[model samples]
Target: MRNTRSVRTHEPSFHQSALMDLRRGGKFAAVFLVLVFGAMGLFLVAALVIAKQSIPDRPAIASPPAEGVGSAPPSGSAAAATGQDHRREQLVRFLTAAAHPGQPAWRTWMPAKADTSSAFVYTPLSPADPGAREAGPGATARVRPSALTPAQTASMLEAVTRRGSVRPSSVAVSHASGRASGWTLDFVVRTSGGNWLEGRAAGSDRASGETVLSQLTYRR
Candidate 1:
């Protein structure tokens, strides 16, 4: 029998025909270019959105003792005026509540913090002297919560803060051994860069001329 080559099938599946054509470069290049551009566009859009979100939107809160308090106003600045007013209000609120009502009628002046002000009132209600112990040998002399001799209070205040107030917000009551008692306040209050100060009370023993122990030095 004469052998004959089997007739090959002419019809190919749609996928097979498509795969055979992939060897051609133009279509594949076009598809790859489209995909590349689309990815790049997405990346660019994402970067733009991120760039817009990185900025801050609000002003910062100012600190206490900001410039422009208790001083002459600058010629034409709204910002300075606002700062000055705020500082004044803070000082008034703080100092008014801290007024003294004793006999000597002493008050705080030249607060180490130029941004703030303080005042006080007093009564000779101290059960005992607070500074006697700390003022003892080797201890620094300071105003006591008990009836303070004005001279003693002044001396201690000068030693600590280099300022003086006839009245203070709190009192210093310590034991004879330098320990505070019954809400004993630290009368030897100092500034961050200044010495401690001793303050006087409001009232006084008229005959003794000594200030009654009502108020003393402290931070709170």
Candidate 2:
């Protein structure tokens, strides 16, 4: 008999193979879950950014003006007209007070350095009458305008002032035309005694930039 050597091959055990398969399956499952969750998170973040970009920005709201306040100040001719009206009102108040020195209500209206010595002219024209008509070639000679003495002007102003005092609200002033220089103001005063008294007062600036009364007239 020849000497024979037999070689035995050993196969892996069932327990070891099962353990290796379990570890491989666990690793693959973990990697798949991680990829799925990461992709979903990135998608959600991108959707949020896209939505925010698509929305428009809102505009700012303007606040409203306060009570009794206007949107804008008066300008141009409107401002000038407003100033002129204020000056005329001041003149009316001044004249009203000067005409009646005895009235306590008008005392506050008189200025400290008011000058009333200037010449005052009188006319029969009504305060409501339009500007003087131009003289026609054949028209009769117009009567010359008369100057009032200081005493007469004072008396006339007193009468007119009394009329105005009866109803202070009835006193109104307007612009008088036909004056070449300076400003002429026409005023109407209603009295309880009888007809309304109409008057005209003119003023001009002096060399010292002070306003001085140039003329005045009043009639029933």
Candidate 3:
């Protein structure tokens, strides 16, 4: 063979190196995509846990009041009793202030103060005489307050809620000038029960002329 040189059928070293570098680059891209997605998933899980911990918990509300509502009395001494206990329950159990009223029906009354040490007095709706009972049958008893403390007066006033179909027609409290003491409180408790049952109570400390005026008007 006359001097014909066989051409080298081989790539340059630089070209071969470039081909190897391309292959490695493809693997690196795939691994980079996986690592990027995995980092995003971890960040999302961390965010969810932080949000869950941010919320605060609270307690529940209380239920409603009872039917008769035996709460603390506002004036004198609050008492708790049912409406049906008018006749049977001792009226004395409800006595509080000065006197239960009796009268020609005054329109207003001033009740005793929260600070006074005055004694409570009882004034029956009807007379203690048996004749008074004879006039009204089933109206067997009328026990007003004979004596009462502050709480006792509140108890008596609470009794107004008793009796069938009872409603407070008008309840008023007032105080007036007394001869000896500073003032006298008059509680004018007027109620309706198919008829009017008006009871009154007055009270005084060491003051004379302090008493309640009670009046009950029954209409047939």
Candidate 4:
């Protein structure tokens, strides 16, 4: 009798089959999750890029101007004119004060070094009293026949007592001819005696560089 080898068929058990199915299902779930998350990340990146390109650029802002940039100082001629106007105004005030009644007022306008030898000539334009004889154009009165100082002139003027007040009007000032720093003024004043007085005054600088009255004459 020939020896017959028994051929046994090997088969997997139920537990092993169940374990293999579980492992295959787990791998399929992991692959699906990875694909979904990767697609979502790509979509987010594309959306950000498109948004950046659609936005408009902002405009630049300008700065303010510096201090004192637009304004300029006065020119030389303008400054000179302003100085001349101021000097003229000062002279007017001085003339007004000099004609006023009191000795104190006269001193306020007179400079400290005023010429002691200054001359004052007066011509009558109208008589103090209507009945009195009117002086002719050529006739004049030298209030101070001798060379009198400003103080002496003021005292002499004060001595001629008059009833009404004195005030200046129709004043005109001009630059002296051929003299750079000289000025001449012409003015009319209503005297304390109810008569009109016309006056001319010229100013010059002294040796000590001080401006003082060189000539002062009046017509009444």
Question: Each candidate's root-mean-square deviation in Å?
Answer: 15.5, 15.4, 15.0, 18.6
Clash pairs (backbone) in predicted model 4? 125-220
Q: What's the ranking of the predictions by TM-score, best on top?
A: 2, 4, 1, 3
Off by more than 4 A, model 1: 1-23, 58-220
Query: Roughly what TM-score does model 1 have, to 2 decimal places?
Result: 0.27
lDDT of 1 by residue, 61-107 (tens): 77777477758755546654443343333223333333322323233
- Candidate 3 all-Cα RMSD: 15.0
Estimate the lDDT of model 2: 0.53
Q: Against the hidden true structure, what lDDT does model 3 obtain?
A: 0.39
What value does the lDDT take at residue 43 in candidate 4? 100
lDDT of 4 by residue, 1-220 (tens): 9999999898889999999999999999999999999999999999999999999888777677688865777787765565455444544555565555454554433444444455333443334322113334445444322344554455444322222244434344443232326666565556656666556665654455444544455644
Using lDDT, give the best candidate's number. 2
| Superposed Cα deviation of residue 10, candidate 3 (Å) | 5.6
Each candidate: what lDDT? 0.39, 0.53, 0.39, 0.52
By TM-score, who's the top model here?
2
Better of 1 and 2 by lDDT: 2
Better of 2 and 3 by lDDT: 2
Tens digit per residue, CA lDDT, model 2, 1-220: 9998998788779999999999999999999999999999999999999999999988878788798668678776676565456545655665556556444433332222343433333332332211123323222112121233444434444543553453445657755443223666777766667557776766654445445455555653
C-alpha RMSD of candidate 4: 18.6
Considering only N, C-alpha and C atoms within 3 Å, which residue pairs clash in candidate 2?
none
